[model samples]
Target: MSPVVVLVGPPGAGKTTVARRIATRLGLTFRDTDLDVEELTGTSVQDIFVEHGEQHFRALEEQAVATALAEHDGVLALGGGAVLSDASRALLREHRVVFLDTGMAAAVARVGLNGNRPLLLGNVRSQMKGLMDHRRPLYAEVARHTVLTDDLDAAGVVDEVLRLIEQDRA
Candidate 1:
């Protein structure tokens, strides 16, 4: 399979939205690892976290990401926490990984205190802050390019990504 352009970021960084647009513009398939995990397990991510726990969910996520990297020749968006695992990070290193970086305020504004996000269910602002602090370095380590999404909309992010990809090619 051809190499993939993988999107990795914290939630609300617009990975999914930007990936879809980029995939359309570039004529590539769009695959979200979280969605793949959900489909394979026949349950929502929230349910997986609630019932089976984060560890289990992450195992499934690892598998999903590995599968996407190995078999997909397109745009792939990984779940926010996917980069935490060494296995996932190793897989990402071989692909064109884009890190959509967003500040805590922007992330909180975009994700809110939605119950859908199991980790941010309580004190979302603080949780998001902590998450960003913890995961920022990992995202940076695995990503070939880092796109700041604090002020960029989905279209703007896609535009920036396309520019960066073109630059990489050049």
Candidate 2:
């Protein structure tokens, strides 16, 4: 199997951007769970939540994660809360997981005032901070490597991920 590299992080942590770069550098197919979910459902994530609620959206998110994990060769960027699901976390354990860690200020700035993020719609700063507190430990537990993204640009983060992949191979 071509090794799978899974990127997990909170919103605005540059997971998708870095995952895309890393996939390109490694000659792997790129897949984002959120994108897949949106594509499969034919609706924006915000619309899903507003129409069907979080529980419904999460069911779709879980399915997306499962499909991504089953792929033999690809870079997968998971939704921010995907790790919260036990089934999703279990599937991720089969891959090389990377946590793109960033601070609350950075996350807030990056995510901005996006109401599309259901969890981050109101008082996003505080919501983000709370998410970080809850999710950071889970990210650490699942990740084979952690890249601090506070100061790194997307390219720099991709470089770090590449180095880690090389190290693992060595």
Candidate 3:
């Protein structure tokens, strides 16, 4: 099955939240690969990263994304670094990928320096900056559309994504 909309972005770019709205608007189901990974492993992502490290987490993420992309013909939200995997990027090529972009300030405001995030432990802003710098190109490469979410609420993001998809169809 092919997803109607596959959202890819940085950690706090509102992919999960906006995906839900887009799914509802389009009468499609919503699936977050991150949540799926958690459900499959019966553990939080933070714990996975802390205990087994990023490589292990990425492996799980790869499996989760692959399964979702294959089985779900709806809206799928991938983890921030899920696109880093070459296999995931290849899978994304067959679907309508939307990159949800947000500025560092807005992302920080949304996510904060919480302990729940394993990557932003020492310095949130710096970590986010580095992630953005590295992953921006990858996101652009895989995404058919990019929606800026810094100034938009969840509803606004959903509207923009819908408009972009409609434009692409035309």
Candidate 1 ranges beyond 4 A from true positions: none
List per-prediction Cα lDDT, in the order shown: 0.91, 0.88, 0.91
Expressed as tens digits, the lDDT of each residue in 80-99 for candidate 1 is 99998999898788888999
Off by over 4 Å in 3: none
lDDT-based ranking: 1, 3, 2
Q: Candidate 1 — what's its lDDT?
A: 0.91
Tens-place lDDT per residue, model 3, 11-102, is 88988988898989999999999999899989999999989999999999999999999999999999999989999999888889999988
lDDT of 3 at 130: 90
Candidate 2, poorest ten consecutive residues by summed lDDT: 1-10
Poorest stretch of ten by lDDT in candidate 1: 1-10
User: Could you tell me the lDDT of residue 96 within candidate 2?
Assistant: 93
Question: Each candidate's TM vs. the true structure?
Answer: 0.98, 0.95, 0.96
Model 2 regions more than 4 Å off: 1-3
The true-versus-predicted C-alpha distance at residue 80 of model 2, in Å, is: 0.5
Local accuracy of candidate 2 as per-residue lDDT tens digits, 35-80: 9989999999889999999999999999988877876477889999
Clashing pairs in 1: none
- Tell me how many residue pairs clash in candidate 2: 0
Top-scoring candidate (TM-score): 1
